[model samples]
Target: METTLHHLHRPLGSTGLNVSPLGLGTVKLGRDQGVKYPNGFRIPDDSQARQLLALARGLGINLIDTAPAYGVSEQRLGPLLQGQRDHWVVVSKVGEEFIDGRSHFDFSPAHTRLSVERSLKRLKTDRIELVLVHSDGRDLEILQHSGVYEALAELKREGKILGYGLSGKTVEGGLLALEHGDCAMVTYNLNEQAERPVLDYAQAHGKGILVKKALASGHVCLKSDEDPVRLSFELLFGHPGVGAAIVGTINPQHLSDNVRTAAAVLSQQQ
Candidate 1:
């Protein structure tokens, strides 16, 4: 079987940004999972990370999602994508504090502005493609009162950010953001379709929907004995509301597998 994965392009909601159906997630790149791999798992060196990023680009994976809270993920991804920044879309989050050996949510306006500046420095980029408000499972009041959204709007206008979105842990948060946010990043999977209403609403309203935990945080993958992780990827891609799925993998073979799944889904759609 020739396993050269091909690209599948799609529109990213109403942003008019063309992206692949699948995107690279950099969460694990910043964390120490301590999980054993058959090929001896280890974090990729800078060169290795760059090589993988190149492979993703070649495979037509355009969006790369990262976060400051994800350990040193932003730092690792920044230099790797130095020159070819224009070829990919970068999405990051704010409204959270990661310092002093602890993590906490702080959506205050000052903290939000500080987060954007820090992310820009870490990304080594003059402008971010997308910046999302990282919600802390609180009521909508935090998002409204924190003034973070206003700051993000200002950044968008100043060209520091191309667009703004919200990442919420709950459907209510997603819904609120959809009604009031520019875009939404939500946890949507085959097992938990709670966000379906919000997804539909976003689609109808021309709001972008970037799906996270599409594989249920690896639960669906662990339960499967297949090549493509078919169920998880297919379920999300088949949904009309999902603009893109951000899946993570440090293994080259796993990356290839994800692209294969994306190609398969595109073929089925056609």
Candidate 2:
């Protein structure tokens, strides 16, 4: 029912970044301590991870999403992606860190600067294509009180980050961040659509939009005969401003299925 979809490289708003319709989220690649995934699993070893990354790229995936909150994901990718850095759009986040099976947040300007530098190191690269404030759901408070956005902007000016934004939870916070940053990553799936307004604002303002949990974080279960994945993808792709949907899956077949479903959706849209 689905085919290839490489023609769907969309612009990530005005940041001048182009990304495939589906992005590979790397949360499962690192953290397993407090994951909410419907299924429990082991973290893939480097060789397995490398295989998955290569398979993703072969399937026309160019956007790889990670964060300091994802345990060793950033660090592992640094070495695994050796000799192939520029081929991918590397996106990392600050403010949230996964440590000792617990999560912590630090949005101070100093920590922000330090975090960006650490990411550059762990990523084994000199520059990060995009960095976002990994908001702790108090998106508005973080935007107003925290110096994180300011720090990322300075880094962008210094050529450390090409652009910065908020992986915010609230629509208002996302819109607020876009006033200062390049894009916003928010949740938008069949099960949750409250944040659709953020996507609307990003579309209208020419700011970028990345969809997280677009498949309901692997919990979008439906009847055996129902094509939930296809329906969910259609809802996301319906928004022309959605640069990509960040789906985390360790299964190569699942990744290919997502790509094919996107292609089918794109075909119908045409």
Candidate 3:
């Protein structure tokens, strides 16, 4: 007989970090102009954002993800997370900036440093727990020539970031990120599995793995009586290398449902 094990949270690779099975993404809390949700939504005000964060904590989510490409998400989080900073694992990204309703990329060493500094200021933190290179899909080129990876590693050495990884769009990029950094964020959903190799490498190497679009960004369609959300977690958490699935939602009810589904899958996993 095999001994069953239980875990309330999953480890982020070998980074010596553990996060809730569900990570709260703050994009919807700030940006709504170019979002791809099923329906339009009003950007939540500060009070509403705070309430969502509180609800997330109560539901056992410990990871919080935001990005500079997310319009005002970093700025909004700085003030809202004032006294509760120590209790969460915050993940932010560099290499992309959203301005004037558009996005632009810069991964030069100078810009990487500047970006991290700006992120620190905007997030009201001296150090970020994890930072990932916001990739531009040129996996091979970015991994080989971008110099952003080395810059982030230097920041980690200098204690500005605890760890750095790649939020990449290609398997090669994800593998290179794991080889050089601490983790890799991939899009693994019921509808897609192209990045399975990256997750396999993480599992083999004891490195971190974060899922970006576990539910296919709400593109999942149910057949018969299948629950897409539940199935997403069943496939996502079923993989031991997956640290957490980052889901961006401002609706409190939807957030609750996500957490509930993740918890159910984790229980089943044990």
Candidate 4:
């Protein structure tokens, strides 16, 4: 019973990138401080990280999501992903940075350019596939007033990044981002449907929609004989605009189960 999602890869809007339905989020690979998971866990060591990556690839996961705000995630992935860069659709972020257990944000064009460059250096890659603005809950303000999206567009034209968008918190921000960007990462799950309009807009416009917090940030309540992960994926994959779901699980067993559940759910879609 080997699980795989190789054939379940979906298009990421008009960006011309195809990602697995379940993307492996690398926040736990390099940072454990101030996370919102149900329980605390140690960051995986080098060998362990390698095994986790191998498992992910074995399960046919091709999308890897990391961000500078994820502490040393970008830096750690640089060396870990040495020669297999082409195997994964690498996603990195700008605008939000975690420092000394506190989160800070900068949406200036200058900072946005600098952030992408730094991420490139840290990830040891020539170009990143996708670069998203890590919103600090000020979705509309950042998308409207801040020059972050403009800077991302410039980077896209310059070939530093193939596509750009926002990991936004509000529906208005997600809608506006889809208007000008390739993708929009929104919070979608059983607990929150406030951003459903954003997904509707993406579906109508052929824009990409990446779902974040699909399992309620690891706070999903358990019921007798019911699988929360499967339920979450059903809600996500049932939608037309969802390109992928970013699940930040560092545990190997959890990863395997997630891919298996996602594969089963997607199999029903066909």
Candidate 4 weakest ten by summed lDDT: 217-226
Q: Estimate each model's TM-score.
A: 0.91, 0.97, 0.95, 0.98
Q: By lDDT, who's the top model here?
A: 4
Give per-residue CA lDDT, model 4, range 1-270, as digits (tens). 798998888898778998999999999997999998878899999999999999999999999999999999999999989989999999999998999999999999999999999999999999999988999989889988998999999999999999999999999999999999999999999889999999999999999888999988888845425888999999999998899999998889999999999999999988
Residues 39-153, candidate 3: write the lDDT tens digits. Answer: 7889999889999999888888889999999989999999998999997899999998888888899999899999999999998999999999998888778778979988998
In order of TM-score, best first, we have: 4, 2, 3, 1
Clash count in backbone of candidate 4: 0
Task: Judge candidate 2 at residue 66 and give its lDDT.
Answer: 97
lDDT of 3 at 139: 75
Error of 2 at 209 (Å): 0.4
The lDDT, on a scale of 0 to 1, for candidate 3 is 0.87
List candidate 4 segments past 4 Å from native: 221-225
Of 2 and 3, the candidate ahead on lDDT is 2
Superposed Cα deviation of residue 189, candidate 2 (Å) = 0.5
Candidate 1 deviant stretches above 4 angstroms: 1-7, 33-41, 225-228
lDDT of 1 by residue, 191-216 (tens): 78887887888889888899988777
Off by over 4 Å in 3: 1-7, 221-224
